[model samples]
Target chain A: MTRMLTFLVVAAAAITIAACDTTGEQAMVPGAKYSMNVEDGRFHNIHATGQKLACETCHAGTEYQPDFVTLSKYADDGGASPGIVDRAACLGCHKAGGIATAWYGGRATR
Target chain B: MVKFIRMIDMERCIGCRACVAACYTENYHTSGAPWNAVIEHEIGTYPNTGLAYMPINCMHCEDPPCKKVCDDMGAHAISKNEFGVVLIDYEKCDGCKYCAAVCPYGVPQYNETMMELYPGKGRTPYENVSDTDRHPTHRKKPKVMEKCTFCWHKLEKAVADGKTDRIGRDPEYTPSCDVVCPVNARLFGDIEDPNSAVAKGIGAKKATQIKKEYGTRPQVYYALVGGDF
Candidate 1:
């Protein structure tokens, strides 16, 4: 009986630790290898807006320096005319349920 | 011995926000954090109402309140270099935001998260680009207060590249916003150099600085559309 009780306590502690580690991983933004995605997007969006230019206009796969993967999978799909992005493309990352929407609430109409 | 100055012609400004956009792209790291702001104010009652578009940026003052408050905090993070550029050292800053709180112009911005200007180059957003490709004029830290450096990096590059004569003349060296102005409403150059176009333009226009009562003595001069606006 004593041995069984000790085993049960150790198992519970292990499960708790495992749960915490998994939670931490899930909380992290996906595809965020080096930088926080939110902050990166903020700078990118600001620059695009400030220049009166679109992100896809310069950074599309056709551009000399393309980092479409940083934006969305749509660009990765090799769709032509990446120069002009629409609400659908924007919503992929900035979805209503995404971390970005949660932080900014609603998108600016520009 | 040249003092830098900017002249903004309000009469020619169409409120297209091209200058604002150019400023953001050139200084994307601090882009959303506006160094130049466009405030649209309307005057008059009905059909005769007129809209005034005012673009505001850091004065780079003779006696900057932001610097005074930073000095008072004992941090001394903000200071005016010999060229009259107001700069903040992020490494020395404790993110106390004391400078932001006291800035009458509201130029300082507190960056909470790390942002990568050049993405997907094996660089983390939190990593400071100033550590590697140090901006020719100003050094930037990941998390700190930052504002418009007036494209100091480009200016320094031009000087280093032995194009000192083109400091104010080169469009690439010019602040992105100033260069992108469709109507040629913005002028940038050394104020002390009477020959420079910016100085001559402001002199001819009788340009005025905003909020002169604060005594910031801003380098940015504006030719307002109407009197006392």
Candidate 2:
């Protein structure tokens, strides 16, 4: 009984650790991990129009690219999604008093 | 013993982006690597809301964290000159970006690809210059970290010509962004010289460097919105 309890406790701790790592990587997807889409319901839920945006809507643009140095900290690959460079795409809906959260000049604070 | 520094009066900034445009044009930076940026933040709340604009560049600290990290990684690409300007040698940069990870200000920008200024349209006249003809700072390469050099190219020319006295007073010797400020919000000169405009401004305005807790001892000072501490 002692052996079984110890094994179960160790297994639970391991699972918790793994779960935390995954959560840390996924929590700030819109800011850091834009390349990897989150299965969270908020990923495509455009606020005002209630439109479900396709990946291309935000990912298709070469005009502005992500600051690779900043992105690399979050994404191990050290690169943003193809054509999804800077926050230019999200600015359309993420400015002051915009449909989504306020993000300006690499800051998401208000 | 001349330590160059910049003093920005943020109280006078109108967020026109003229300084940003000037830096981009003067440096001829490719897409994604802006040497200067004007960060906007919504301050206060409700009816008391206000927008604060902070024009930031490389802090060019007395003890730069970027240089420390780069040197630790055995890159040794980052160097601080006698004039107190921090610069990166493009050739020596391995693009490992360890410096980027440590920088408190998020100053280093990694250029993955040298994209055209006007994408799909073509390179601008500024971008079309040959590497041989351009200043070393302007000779940008892909897959390397880049940041503002405090317009070291122009400052170097002043030193070469023995006209360091003309630095803050003349456009040829001044940082491009400082030279183009519509409002006289930007001042660049020798901070070590007690009589210099920047030094006097620092005293008169009680100018303070941002992120003081970092202990980097930045050369860039700002007359902040509320008050300089």
Candidate 3:
């Protein structure tokens, strides 16, 4: 009975922690604290409301390895994991006259 | 007026890393990143699966993306020589790795530290050579990008010796990787001359450049098992 009660308490705590770690809708902005890890991704929020950004937009068909940022390929689902993001891919949407803010060279242009 | 080109016949390649070892002996590479690598990939289905070895060095593209990216970032570190060999000026590079990030082939490796070839065994005699004695390409430093020069040091020597016509035939003029290939799988020569050995070999084998869609127009060509890819 003691062991069963202990197991139940630990399981309940884990569930509570995971629920608390969920990202809110407000964290989908440009400079938000987003996780690069696909497993813990809030990409759905970024892709919500007519965004419709595909996974291949930033990843796939690339072998570039950047030293600036760490890329994660973690995925819980048994799906095709996204490849590492090349800076060229980032420039596609992040450069001047693009969708996102023109941010590069250690600063953001508003 | 010579345009150098390197060719690899994949069908004849036995996956023997002799070319890779020859590169290390010729160039001082960091611990993790090598100037040359022989990658093995599978072709065909499970029933008809076969492996293919691709020995890759710097393609020395005619319009190198690494140079363009470096110039765009105001680095001005990379330069394509008259011979169409892409080289990085280590002094100008700040190790930002922007070139590394933009390269489709994953060339341009950054050396974090000057690790000895043998760990805890002290520097090898090759590594202990004075910097003055070493060629600029072989003088590797920490926190900078490095890649194959297509053995420009040898090519430069060939030019100085007035043996430009005998590059592919001369041992001192040819790239160490090509010279060391036991199976004669690798070839290096000027592709400008329609009568040159490399030009003839490429035409006869129907060799094609890989990743041509990137539009880098790499000078290196590969003779795959089948026809051009």
| lDDT by residue (tens digit), candidate 3, A1-110 | 99999999999999877655443333333212432223444343344222555555566553344331234545233344443444556556544456753332222111
DockQ of each: 0.01, 0.03, 0.04
TM-score for candidate 1, please give it: 0.60
* Winning model by lDDT: 2
Writing each residue's lDDT as its tens digit, candidate 2 over A9-95 gives: 999999988776554432432212231122332334332113434445665632324443245445653234453224345556644
Candidate 2 stretches with Cα past 4 Å from truth are A1-110, B226-229
lDDT of 3 at B192: 90
Per-residue lDDT over B8-123 for candidate 2, one digit per residue giving the tens place of the 0 to 100 score: 98888999989999998888777898889998877777999888788999999876767765664567889988788899999998776656655667799989899987789977
Error of 1 at B165 (Å): 3.4
lDDT of 1: 0.63
Candidate scoring better on DockQ of 2 and 3: 3
TM-score of chain A of each: 0.31, 0.34, 0.37
**Per-prediction TM-score, chain B alone:** 0.85, 0.97, 0.96
Q: Candidate 3 has which clashing residue pairs, if any?
A: none
- Single out the weakest 10-residue window by summed lDDT for candidate 1 chain B: B122-131
Expressed as tens digits, the lDDT of each residue in B75-170 for candidate 3 is 788988777788988888877665665565778888878899899999988788988998988888898889999999999999899998888878
Best by DockQ: 3
* TM-score of each model, paired residue for residue: 0.60, 0.68, 0.72
